[model samples]
Target: MMGGLSIQKQRRLIVFAFITVPLLLLLTFAYYPALELIRLSFTDWNGISAEKNFIGWANFKEVFSNPEIFGVFKNNVAYFVVGIVQNIAAIYFAVVLNGKLRGKNLFRLLLFLPYILNGVAVAYLFGYVYDTTNGSLNYMLGQLGFDKLSETSWLGNTSIVNYSLASIGFWRFMGFNMVIYLAALQSIPNDLYEAASIDGANGWQKFIYITLPNIYKIIELNLFLTVTGALEVFDLPFVLTRGGPAGASETFVLKIVETAFQFNNYGLASAMSVVLLLFVIIILSVQRYLLRGKGE
Candidate 1:
């Protein structure tokens, strides 16, 4: 069919074919499933049932009316707050590592190592660290003479359990965020900093004017990712606490899983999923608008 086509046209056709095939596959596998999930949210199906009765807004109504749902959302908000702290810490470390420091590469490697570990493994590892009696943390507190903290149950205490889980998230992800910020820092032109220094700009002033401006977009991107990940956090919390100790650490995504698999309320779970998705979309849209306004 391409026998009469020019050579450049033939090359373009080949490239288009390569792109089109994967695009089709992505639509078929990824988008199709997502659309089906949305459709399922409006029905009454136990996932194992042969009949899926259309229930209009009933599932959404149930989700909105449930009081427990608010608590799950509050936990998600706490996760997002902790994620903000993680990004701040990551940026600080990235700035320090980008400086004239020794063993920077080694430090970066050590920090990033946790991010590559399996989530389940990390969860179990932290589970031991948070054990009430035998955990390393309490043991260290004992050695430090803070005997009172040594007996405290890290994961069992309702007041601080969510913070404890959020700390694990920080530890696991701070390094990854640091690496991203480091890359962004390196991309910033050195000449800009030199120019600022020549004008007698102090370290803090230079950071505010040059560093922050240059990496603002990267920071926005990271915030978007952090917020989405925060809202959808599941694996670590699931494995570590099973959303237990009086459901103090249950995340929104974990609640969805519990409702669907444990409670066999597949339709309700789907409705929750859709609500979460819409919430994410709205938040991201606001973030985009703010970033655009700042850029302008």
Candidate 2:
């Protein structure tokens, strides 16, 4: 029995080692760099310099004092709000596509196709679309009765650039969300709808009571994903506006990258990154707490 126990312990150790090695590697490679960045946020160290000096709270104060940072923060919030709208729109579109319709597969493919393109490529494409002179938008507007319309620089305006970039997010992810909702919709039993109809419940009533409640878990999951995705928005804005003409469209991730790579202020960027991580955790926790359900 003692020899058998020893053999069991040895096997367990081997299994644990197998599982732990990759995770430890990930932490070593990924987490240490992140932690180092966070620690650096307390200091003033240029990326190229070997000399590191600690300046506590100063970097944070500078970050907060800069209106551009907060302006970018506002842009992030706006993107979050727009993302909710986009998710709702995606669900609606998904519901439509899930219905028995011709070219439904084609519609799904078309909608999701934009997600496959490189964000930088998409930015350049839209740049041409919104170009002030001889652009497609201006040409369309001119051809329309709005001949007096000014040729608007869609990517250049601080006020509209965030939304313009967000529109790309909407177009790219809407199809993905639609597919998720479509899968959820398909999972819902048809008998519930039939019963609702038998009870003289109208379409709206069925949708509100049956369809929504059934898909609430999916909604919760998707909302969590969208919230995180919105918070971490970088590529689209970076490529489209590079935080823009006046630092208007900068997101939290973009700010972090700019601080670390561009400004070589690694410490401040890490601090901001930690804050962003905390923000995401809080948002997700609140959402999960609020959306807790029997099914989930």
Best by TM-score: 1
Q: After superposition, how far is residue 279 of candidate 2 from its true place, in Å?
A: 1.6
- Model 2 poorest 10 in a row by lDDT: 63-72
TM-score of predicted structure 2: 0.86
* Candidate 2 Cα errors over 4 Å, as ranges: 1-18, 148-150, 294-296
TM-score against native, each model: 0.95, 0.86
- Evaluated at residue 256, the lDDT of candidate 2 is 85
The reply for model 1, stretches above 4 Å from the true place, is 1-6
> For residue 187, what is the lDDT in candidate 1?
95
Cα deviation of 31, candidate 1, in Å: 1.5
**Residues 189-218, model 2: lDDT tens digits:** 999989998999997898888888888888
Q: Each model's C-alpha lDDT?
A: 0.90, 0.81
